[model samples]
Target: MKLKTTLFLLFSILGFSQQNNPASTDSIKKTNIFKLGEVIVTNHQNQETTNRVTSKTMESQNKMEVSRALNLLPGINLTASGSRNESMVTIRGFDLRQVPVYMDGIPVYVPYDGYVDLARFTTFDLAAITVSKGFSSIIYGPNSLGGAINLVSRKPTKKFEFDGSLGLIDTDGQRSNLNIGTNLGKFYVQGGLSYLDRKYYQMSKDFVPMKNEDGKERDNLYRTDQKVSIKIGWTPNKNSEYALGYINQKGEKGNPVYAGSDTQNSLLARPRYWQWPNWDKESIYFISNTHLNDKNNFKTRLYYDKFKNLLISYDDANYTSITKPYAFQSFYDDYTYGANLEYESRFIPKNTLKFAVQFKEDVHRENNAGEPVRRFDDQTITIGLEDIYKVTAKFTVIPGVSYNSRENKQAQDYNSTTKAISDYPNAGKSEALNAQIGLFYQFTELQKLGASVSQKTRFATIKDRYSYRMGTAIPNPDLKPETALNYELNYNVQFFGKLNFQTAIFYSSLTNVILSISNVEPGKSQMQNFGEAEYKGIEAQLSYTPIQKLIITANYTYLERKNITNPAVHFTDVPNTKVIGTVEYAPLEALKLIANTEFNSSRYSTSYGISVPDYTLLNGFVSTKVLKYVSIDAGINNISDRNYSLVEGYPEEGRNFFVTVRFFNSN
Candidate 1:
């Protein structure tokens, strides 16, 4: 299969390249940062880049989740999950929770369920994003079965620097970010603050009302978020450094519910009743690194994180009625503390050996209305080792192994007025062994081929074990860990010296898949390991420098997910196809124009086959440096005014505009 895919991709890209004029390789840098597509691989870590969104593009565009920064990459899709402010990032047909998120190589996903709300991660100080998918290194911890995303923050390189920006958008939304930093030779300090205010926004004119609800969407649907970040660093020598960093964010956003009856082909069944009153997060981390010598290196990291959220609702279907006042005001809190250490041995000429050890503990507690708190603790330990062996000048092989031990501790608050608690010790303990093998062969200076096979496993979350799914699905505490065996083949080529073409074909067989299924009768659900499943996909990216001043890039993904046991007629929560294209033109050195479009096919939210309407968004932005230290940006999103929603009944903003002004100085 890999050989067929390689040959097909080679012939296809080579034939396509013959249609374009020859240009310089330097002009083929990625469009988002360096230019559109250049392939660069790291020999030390065995990491490679297929695409990246440069800081320059991020600086000019409207900032949101880190997911938004990589939307153009193939097989990467963003879906509206629980609420408008909550988004789920799906990679290669995998659920959002199956993928792990990282910041500067530190895990940030809530330890209880390994879920991270991308909306809360505003792009305030981000420098770059790296996506490492299947066949990833063994050191990235557990629960990264599908993929991992790393958000890298920027560090000031100059002696003194200051940057600030303010943006205004439609629907009374406004935002501002301020940053200041300095590199004082021995000790350095940096910090940034961000504020965003969002009020009710409008939908497309073509939208059709459902469940007799007004076509005008909802009222008081607004959001406000703020962030603060600080970092301090000390450099005692050229090859060693120690740093500490802190981040805090708080916000509240209304959640829209599905109206009327989605089970009966009704797009809008339920009405919007509950809204997230407050969502807050805080993080502090310390990083230390030193090079013992040229052949060996050592690094360590420590981090602590806290997350809090509030959900509440009251009143009835109409404004004049009050049926369930003070119905519920729930508070959820989670705390995590973790430490990791890594050692790299390069004693051999062409072999790089890496060993990693990590420990993490998560304490999660929640209060119902005004009741006592129910707490759960999750503990984990992982040890991993890998070696990248360079067999020849053009051939490389990587083999790795990891062992993970996870234990869950549970305690529940009494239902009565008494404030006593009952504790259950060691509710679940799961241990797994995973391994992987990968090979990269440089067929030629302009062409490369890579293939890998991996075995991965993920443990169940606390909620997935004990809590009922909002009175619908019953949770079973004895659920087993989900596991998968993945295979992938990759081909990359540079054509005409100005075009970068890359393609990958991947397949996975997943077992012990946790899902909600029929309990015994109708209208009831139970969480269970339903059956085995298969997933396969093809992703391709083509970047061309048609001219020195004009660049074009396009990416597409085709995915198929099948339930081997059930043989269902529809695929739930997964889009079959995703596509993105971009055009960046610089008519003048100081003036530039950019445009991109994203497309997603229909997606089903349930086994019953109700789906969210497909959508195509057209966006464009123009930026100009009008002054030596000042720049201006303006853009329009969803320019086509297409009435659509990523999640059923939760309409997205339509035809919105934003403008920003930035002031920065590095000297």
Candidate 2:
């Protein structure tokens, strides 16, 4: 399959590359600091870019996972479950529980819902993404105390067009996608659909089914997921525009990859087993994303996301005795509405000032047949002002201040049967005032230096305020918000040569940290306001393209995290060191072949002791343009099929292959 893809791509390139085309805006800004598609980006430039591995869009694929892709950045760690989406992201040694995420400058974070399922998001229509490490994210509120990820969706192009991709996987896996766009007078419409499916994989030579608690053997289950979206935009004139979009997704949940089975201490180890659920989600969004007179920015959006999950499991005692099965049926509804306004202008000849205001509300409700009904409501408002004073042609100073207020409410209702869990306002009405100051200096034509200091806050999430479960999961309503004092230094130097390198270092002190700690008994845990935690790290990135068709890149990160309370317990799940390297060869304009590898060091599972071993994996892919409007590609993951475990008891997929095909209609 890979060979076929390679041949197809070669032919496509031969036919397509021969015809020269106009260069894109991204290509022109390849080396510019504010270029549109440059991977190394400084959204607002917290520091120097030449030394920072700041941004990336196609690290592995055109679509990259926030956790997996961001981990390549210096001081960033992604704690995930076999790349299946339920993972958490941590930066600069801070816990995933503290980091926040944004979309197009809007705070898309849920006040109390710490889980930002990255699996549900796609980068199909994104212009660029910015990842602010350490104190760099102070400009954004709330979760920015730990750092932040900003996903910027692309706007409609001036001309109508279409683009898409297709592929297949080895051993009964296949995928395909299609996208189309058109502009009729003042109205624009776009629609897209994608389908993906993978069969169960065998991890080892003795790949026998695992026995369940009841001693019944269980088979590995893969997935078949589908996504569809349609969007429409209307522009009365240059002054206003509105967009409406709907996204729907449905798929099988993934079972935790497992390591081994303990026949004697089966009970303790069994709790670590994983099972995929039967679930689905659908959402609708409306946005008035328009610029006022091209100088002022304004946006208003509303969205609702609905999900249904069917969880199946058996009791521990069901091993020796036969018992009826239990199923947890749950439905989740999320509604969000928000607006933002911003203005940028130069009040003084060489001085620039920017002011912005934002408001957002989120409501989530979860209902289960036998469990208590859960409701979460949260709202936030923020006002900010910043001034950039150009001290001289070679230097600038930026000073900014922001005031934000947040309110969250959680309620659990009961009607007999099971007792209602505690309902507490863990995060009351809280408000914070943060301030930041940054200085940028151009040392020479080839060197730039930047430094910044800031104060930031992270509010308690809904899960911390009102979460309850048995064995290893307990909610603490008394958990307090997290705060941080951060410092950063960036250095970027460019020499008159073919080689380019970037480096950045950051440090932060976090107080009132929020974390999940295991209790005395197994399968029991609680979330609380732990004491201070310190995280510091540095990142280095190097890239060189000998020619337009060949590119090589390498990245490395080193991070350290410690709990101020004990100082001995190393933060869990975060790896101390990570490295990635990639090589791409584009022999023909339409043909691209890439080889990539990732390395992760040993990591802890719990603060007390249990840890996972370090491992490295190699993967490769070849993509080809089969025709003017179609393309094909194939790749292999876990090439060696190493039997390794990321999370306890959960084993990862062994060697696997996938193929995809794409179709586009521009006319």
lDDT of 1 by residue, 500-559 (tens): 888899999999988767754467777677778899999998889989999888899889
Model 2, span 282-394: residue lDDT tens: 66766664555544545454555555555444333222221334334445656666655555566477766667676767677776656655777778777887777889988
TM-score of each: 0.89, 0.81
User: Looking at model 2, which ten-residue stretch has the lowest summed lDDT?
Assistant: 32-41
Best by lDDT: 1
Clashes of each: 12, 28
Residue 295's lDDT within candidate 1 is 85
Error of 1 at 78 (Å): 1.1
The most accurate candidate by TM-score is: 1
Off by over 4 Å in 1: 1-51, 82-85, 217-220, 259-272, 317-326, 413-420, 520-523
